[model samples]
Target: MSGEPLPPVKRVVIVGGGTAGWMTAAALSRLTDAGVAVTLIESEEIGTVGVGEATIPSLLDFNRYLGIDEDAFMAATGATFKLGIEFVDWADRGDRYLHPFGIHGRDVHGVKFHQIWLRQSRLAGRMGQVGNVSDYCLANQAAASGRFTRPVPDPAAVLSSFSYAFHFDASLYARFLRGLAEEAGVQRIEGKIVHVDIASDDGCIRAVELADGRRAEGELFIDCSGFRSLLLGDALGVPFTSWQHWLPCDRAVAVPSASTSAPLPYTRATADSAGWRWRIPLQHRVGNGHVYASAFIDDDEATAKILDNLDAPPLDAPRPLRFTAGVRERLWERNCIAIGLAGGFLEPLESTSIHLIQSGITRLMSLFPDTGPAIAERKEYNRLLRQEYEQVRDFVILHYHRTNRTDSDFWNYCRTMAIPTTLEDKIALWRAKGRIIRDQGGLFSDDSWIAVLMGQGLIPQSHDPLADALPIEEAGRFLDHLRDVIARTAAAMPRHIDFIASHCRSDLAA
Candidate 1:
């Protein structure tokens, strides 16, 4: 290694201009104290795939990091609160479950709360007084009752265990972030990139030549070019590893519908014959989509199904999207780093798309390199990003693979398909006992795993042995008390619509 210190990254060029690009620019511009000049280029003619509207709780961290006010952001995006996702008809035809944003209940006697819940549930089943698992979860109960409230900061409070995200208009969110980015001294260039000029000697990107004969040059390039993967895939020639065999639902038809009633404090995902449909309620309208495998059902049929399922008339014609589920072999290659859809795509089964984007941006910020490329830094960034992608991939796969619905070929394939060894091990452990292996870097926590596993009828054969330390009757009483507390707390909360009106309701005229 050279003894001389490397120069800090002076100029960064971000290609594309949707959520990914703007989020990257806004984050770098605000977070970097070294005064790295950031420039983002995009053409209004090139429309973005703004379908990832529903988000997870981690989005709060992203917003907080950027110093965005919650109420203002919600109003600007026409957002509604999201407590969790309700999976309808997933495990069985009539079965439904809510995967809440928080844990089931507080741990008892140093054992996981879910373990105690399992033990109590088994006992209750024997006594013929089994209760719904969701009853013990504050977020689940609140979502079920169309209630909304900010979580209490004190962990001792019954409502403190829960968290929330948002359902918003993706296009509006991009606009909001763009304003933030531009205000933070980030330059915005409006143009379509005609060509990327590569330095012949080092094979690094030199500049991007726009259609208007203007060349924007930079030392580092961030690719947020959506599925086209402009700089990373086309210019850098990074190979994409397609996971179509595992996640075969490669097409989606999305549309906005008029809101028929007060927006619920959660998202709804109803399983269909060939795939699934999502309903995300926003303040102004509802976002709806059907994600389906083309091999199992044609686009026309999927579109028809989605249209027929809409709660109200569609605001516009259904827009179709095509994608292969997988990530690039390397998210960071040479001097270029790919974020968002350009990096890879896993279907939004659990509303993880935006979170993945946030994770990538955060990781890139953490491993931000100097003006001179560092091979080691690039390798580390790629490794972390790959891990993130794989972890999310496995979690999403669990939803599909751990199913008993064989009414259609798609469902049958998903039910019988082989899964990644990581997921296989996880399933095996859960089946053997109510244990969740925590991944240090994974997005979903143990509580999330437990919720999905139990929701999808993948109940463990027995509770964790540690849970047996407590008497069976004691555990049952504890669960009953917890469920009652959650129910009463949720019942006393303000209605979701009323909460929005009181705090973050949007003035469309503004």
Candidate 2:
């Protein structure tokens, strides 16, 4: 009897090596049995788009799934915990809001917190606008105060019950995953894939032909070839759907700058004339990028805009990247599956790039076939991947479309332009009823849309009628009490810089 555990995926080939490639390999290696053979091929000449330094709370699950040591990973990557993102000047100008990780506040008398706040705002002589939604969220408060503390194990402290993620060096993270993938019996091939050989009978990719005349054959092929898309797009011929109309910022200029005095525990995205600039603080340096549409701004100006907006002195030359913002019509073609830039390029506004890659790898693992790739399996993979990408794309578009900024041509287009009907319907419903169209497939929660909608000055026409069931004075008192409690709790926490220094600081930060 064969000792092997039934040979689930005997051979697997990964044709890329950046964060996406390595992350997929590392994850699949950990999840599958010993009989599986995973191979990753890449060229030293190729470069990775590694500006994705900031992340959301979903990373907690991915890290735990990878069995990564949190402190070690943070220290190695020069990670700073991110509670949420602060959007600057997005509504009109000089306006801001933080899109936090968790819920706003505890519901009272079985009523939604925002509805209660809305009810209070209607009361005569109410001083506060009650629109500062982040106050009730511990993570958002922690971010605003420039403080960080792991939720204490005690259940009573609301601070201990909150969530967070990391802002770190993307390159360092790739190296970390590479090490794990290699240790788990993944064969790392160092060469450029010059060609993909195909089988005559099935037309599936038979093997990847490297520049050095080496052929890497596998029963199933994964194209992680970044924008080159060597196997799935170039060889198998899958069409890509361009979403430039919906997500128009097709160019990006990224630069890393020396750290500000001490790194903060959150990422900042400030709206600009052409597009927006992202500021991600790591231990030793800050990652900066200006994403814009080339139609409105030239390369020289965009580069200058990015350089002028840096938090510190430039540490390296600015690198520019151009991409058509969209996903492939088919993520998996024949026996080959495309991941990362090969799959599609959605802007990293919410840092969904890595998360999408992780999800793709996981879905593949779940649908792992004993034989060659099946159409049913491929179809399901594409369905989930399309939904995930579209959902994130729509959410990112909301930030731009709902804005009141008509200062620049770019902003004017974003503000007045027609958007996806799905998004329009969601916004229209919220404006009338203060109710979010909850969808499980949607990446953002009701709290998220509420933050952006309210931040962009989209208040509901009227408060939730159900909230009227409570006495007017009682509703006002509850709202005031929650706000006070949140403020007091946040005031008692340590500074974010101090929290990192005490718990997660490594040689990188030191």
Candidate 3:
């Protein structure tokens, strides 16, 4: 097997044309410098599912790799900086919390900061003065204050401790990337795929037949065909695995609304009777959606729920989408690789849709294969992506299952549903002792789990023994000083809207 290297790939073909397709195309276009030909096929008649998107901080790395200017990208997408997600009523009615982007206070002498804070909170006298854990998070405080600023390079700076993502128009982001991808020599074909021809010998995709009878062939095929999974599922016959029993929300109704005020620096997810509502603020409009289990709530009620909860008048009629909360049994099959919805979905609850796409592309690039047999590469790719999806799946399910809501059947089912053993183990560890063990390559950090666990009223029975190393009096003083520093730093930043206006205001917004 090690005698000689396989031939290099010369042509790459991508199916579909939304955020996933364009992102893949744009990223792979760099290979054009080495004479690899990249082509993308899509139909104008097909519409994309994303209305507005909330992203995580990892996108910054992807943009940097693509050489995208922050200001230019924001302006092109009518983007608003996002520091975190504000979850309302998830734990119980009237309960709320913020899952911020960065770490919560600095760790003290190699001891986790949360352990120290948890230990301090347990003290009867210091409970009120120490304040909520949110006080120690810069991103949380800044988001609550509607402030925005880029992180500083100095790690010691309070301002540099937290990170920011974005709330933007997803279609516009795809359009922006389309321009970049095309400029970098990616060929876009305007047509729908009518058929996929599979080679008889290896059962690999040979070429895609278009409605107009044109055929596009390539050595490597990328399946970004959204939920259709045209190449990977349809052509290669990969089976779909459903995680609906755990994550029961199966339908969503999304709509855009006029902005009543300045855009906040975070996305909002509010728990509802049957499901939940998401409000993502962009520079030009507010994106609202209701994700509900169709078994418990009808489409009309779900749609009505979102409409009634909007802060401003509607800009258009509501759009509906249906999906199961699961991933494919195998993301990489034969010679075709699935990215985005084609691979699987864990819903947009944590704003992980776009991030998943980025993860798929990053993984593919790392294990990019040549024209010869790629069995080992394919297995590794599938393993990595499957782990990522499950990790994200467990995180998302934590939001629903940890809830105290009993007002609706949907909540009842979610609250009592059987969860994957992986999530069960995670929650068990945290409940016993305030310890968070992150799986390798997991998307969320220990801080994220801490935020949600505590936010959902799942405080542990005890703290780490090491948290007792600091004297109570000294710990209280440190907590007081850190809280004050975070509050002051956040207050010093400009308002979210003001920062965008000065740096990256879109013409539509202007």
Which candidate has the top score in lDDT?
Answer: 3
Considering TM-score, where higher is better, how would the candidates rank from best to worst? 3, 1, 2
Compared with the true structure, the alpha-carbon lDDT of candidate 2 equals: 0.83
> Local distance difference test, per candidate?
0.89, 0.83, 0.91
Q: What is candidate 1's lDDT per residue for 194-297, written digit by digit as tens?
A: 89998776777879999989999888899999999999999989999999889999999999999889999999999999999999999999999999999999
Candidate topping TM-score: 3
lDDT of 2 by residue, 333-426 (tens): 8788888889998888877787788778878888876755576888888899898888888888989998888899999888888998888888
User: By TM-score, how accurate is candidate 3?
Assistant: 0.98
Better of 1 and 3 by TM-score: 3
Which residue pairs show backbone clashes in model 3? none
Full candidate order by lDDT, most accurate first: 3, 1, 2
Cα miss at 333, model 1 (Å)? 0.9
Q: C-alpha displacement of 122 in model 2, angstroms? A: 2.2
